[model samples]
Target chain A: METSAAGLEKAIKAIKIGLSLPEQDHLHRELEELLGWLEPLLAFNTGETEPLLFGHEAVNVLREDHPQEGRLAELQEAAPNFAGGFYLVPKIMD
Target chain B: MELRKTTVRQAADAVWKGEITAHQLIEKTLKNCSVLNEGLNIFTYLAGIDAVEQAKAVDQKIKNGEKPPLAGIPVAVKDDLCYGVLPTGLGSPAFSEFISPVTAAAVERLMEAGAVVIGKTNLDDMGQGSTTLSSPNGPTVNPWLAGRTAGSAGAAAVATGVCMLAVESDSGGALRQGASHCGVAGLRPTTGRVSRHGLNAHCSSFARVGITAFSGEDISEVLDLISGFDERDAATAVCREGISEIIKAPGSKDITIGYPVTAFDYLEPELREIFEQARERFAEGGYRIEEVDLGLLREGLLAYYVIAMAEAFSNHARFDGIRFGKTAEADSLEEMYEQSRAEILGREARRRSIFGAFLLSKDNYGRYYRQALKIWEMVRQEFETVFERCDLLMLPAARSLPRSLEGESGFLEGWSEDLYCAPVSLSGMPALTIPAGQVDQLPVGMQLVGPPFSEKMLLAVGSASGSTGK
Candidate 1:
């Protein structure tokens, strides 16, 4: 259950959460505590049980293919910046 | 003395009879809200002007001799809900300015039924914690006790008489635990029983839009209006007949209520005594009380955290800072995503998101995520077996009464406190928490859990307890 510093850094990077050195130390400690909390699940023999992806009894629910207008204008208005109904972000290409 | 003190049904009756105008009720509710917010911090956003206008419209309808079900009752929704008029912060700084263009289906149904939303109340940021502590505005203080966590701002608003009804959500017992702490009635319907169309997703599969109100009558009435199929939420099934009929009819006299003694080992002496007294009442009233074994359910705490964290990380990936809210000033897109999430997302959220990422990453996916899902299936099956012996299971809503908010470390402690209620969520069953009685001045509550889509039976049991109202 002990999460190494390297493993913690990989988790933060993979999750795209930027943590400062101090925050990283705090979170690393917290993660180790949380992993310790999760120890009970590791002891169970779960090989026979089927993994439940959905909690409900329903299978895949399909609707008819239909084109419908959405609230694009309202969504654009709420965004920080948008042009031609597309969300604006910082430059990704050089 | 305040009109806001009336329950939803009582106020709606008055509005229909012209005893009070909707506008007058909203004004009184706003006044009470101002007073309550001074010490309790009950609301994050008060719908002052819009509420008045909405009330006036209800008054106009009343003048024309039409009656709506909720008719001018003041209501508060949890801030995490996606209502368009007020900006949703989800208790996080990242969403402080986020305007939800779409309204939730349940909220829309309430408005259509003539309920006026007075404000949005605070919750743990993004509903991550059971306590209402993670909000940037700070935690909601319990009105019943000074130092104890007040539950959610929505629960506080109802208990403090600022709003007649409060709309709260539950993934892992947020609404029920809040109700238990605050001495109110909260009902979490079976998952997909109430449409999840307008709710902000945390653990999408586990989360359900529920409500907190003064009485089981109020909660059941709201459930009747909102619990049905929605085209927007494909998971919603066509509701079975007999909900209204069942609520009207008396619950079966020969009912067998299950008590899971093993699951409630953490309960304190005072709360345990109160629970025992209530159990004695049921036994004296000719009801069979069975002690059911919670085999797989004993591991509910670990399974809930694992599944919820994984789903939350996936659901929250939409908060890229480019879509809405304040974005970080950065040179590149990658830096923007990282800096924005890091800067705005709070400690609890960041911890969970990373934990989720770690659980789902590479070999860890099969090791943790899959294993938890299997345990989830086992928990559901165990509940199915338990239900075969009893009509419904009666349990405490919380392990202990509300704890002090002045503590140094509340994050880890809060997660552990959800043990009593998380098992219900893991099984996707219906549960209603009603204030059973009090231990001294503070209130203690008990939860009644039923099989899936058995809301009417649960509400009947709640009503029979005679604790849903003052």
Candidate 2:
């Protein structure tokens, strides 16, 4: 079950969005190094990883706004760059 | 006797028999620590005053005609475990000033059993590296030779002390590898043989509390006191009619030993020579030797890195410059985390944390962590096959002697030695390392491994090797 090239793109996009931090570049370099080492071992599996298994689909649903209020605010405060309910970043997306 | 070489058993017996007061014994041990510790860096902190107080209490207890198993026996505590009054770092700065609110169940159990918690010993930063160089305090060198321990300094913590024994923990090859370097005895107990309530896990699946000691008697006696099941550590099994029971089962002139059929290719000539001689000795001691395949031993390191790093990233996430020790000294919260990450974390720890985060990340979990565990299960099955034919497995503790500081090798070269020992850890089997001989001016060791809960068989084989004399 190798990974589909399309699926790998989606995963890369989703992951790139999540690696927000001051040390993102450090992490980026590390990711490249790690992938360089593990990607070969992974190629055989990626080839077998695709075509989707049962319960493998992601649901594009949003949660109900039931006042699950904001620990995210406090946690965000701990991050290096946040501005007015938004986490500042290198603007990966326009 | 000089404090550096005596076993804790002899000291404890003396303290118990009113032959020496606990304070005097502690003073001698502290003196030894102060002098030898310069070369070793074993103790992260030596509690002269605390040890004196503990000694006083033990002396009082002995006078009151009550004796506990480790009563008055001096033992060094690993710096990573919480010691009530001593500071613990888990090998990082985030928790550097964070003293324990309570003792870890394992240390408490050891103290209750009459062992004096002498001082905190050094460890790899965040328990992330195979070498103690990862420690922010500094690398703990092999006491027998002046360098970072071949696999890790886990030996420097306990065996370097003049005390009878010392406590240690293993998440991979921490105990076995360190003992191999120090040329002393070390035990990696069955995973649940003790408790982890107080210890930090780099990877929960492979972690276990262990002991490094002067002799097999010290190893078993200390383990007996700490090995029982604890409610706090859910993984510990009941005092099974299991492995410990077999250790006590007796009669041992003819035991079967399993040798690594391929470990020789990885071992240096000196170690290969020593291991071959050790096998001959084992055969002469009336044990049948069998060669077996454990390709799993090689995968053990890779799998261990994946598992340990993944868990470590989680365990360390709690120290996000919030709540505890010192603040991350950043103007903003995110800056705080970056600062915290940079300041207290070492090169190995940072590398491991990033790897851990990636392995456990939403995208990579299936490919890394999950597959690693499957490999571990296969290794366990491999162990099962081997044990059916042998009473214990014997192998060189490492590929070479304790390495030098400016090694002809790198940190990975240092960790590569643990390949033989770490698999035993991943399989959660009990193993011990004893000094086989010296190689090129440094001590080398041989490891004896047994099935889960097979401490008795491991030590019986170890004892027969005549490596246990104090």
What are the DockQ scores of the candidates, in order?
0.65, 0.06
| Candidate 2 chain B, poorest ten consecutive residues by summed lDDT | B241-250
TM-score of 2: 0.83
> What would the per-residue lDDT of candidate 1 be over residues B1-470, giving only the tens digit for each residue?
35435566777998999888899989988988888887888788888999999999999998888899999988898888888898787888778777799888888989999999899988887777778888788889999988888776777788887787888789888899888888888999887778888788778878889988877777877887887877788667545332332232334556888987776667777778888898888887667899999866558778888989888888878776776556799887888889888766687778888888888877578878999989999889989999899888988888777878886764667787888788889999889988888876778888989887777877777877747535
Worst 10 residues of 1 chain B by lDDT: B241-250
TM-score of 1: 0.96
**Off by more than 4 A, model 1:** A1-3, A59-65, B1-5, B240-252
Model 2 residue B161 CA deviation in Å: 4.0
Q: Write the per-residue lDDT of candidate 2 for residues B62-154, one digit (tens) a residue.
A: 888988767777778777777868877787766666666557777888778777777787787777655677678777776666644634544
Among these predictions, the greatest TM-score belongs to 1
TM-score of chain B of each: 0.96, 0.93
lDDT of 2: 0.67
Q: Which ten residues in a row have the lowest lDDT in candidate 2 chain A?
A: A49-58
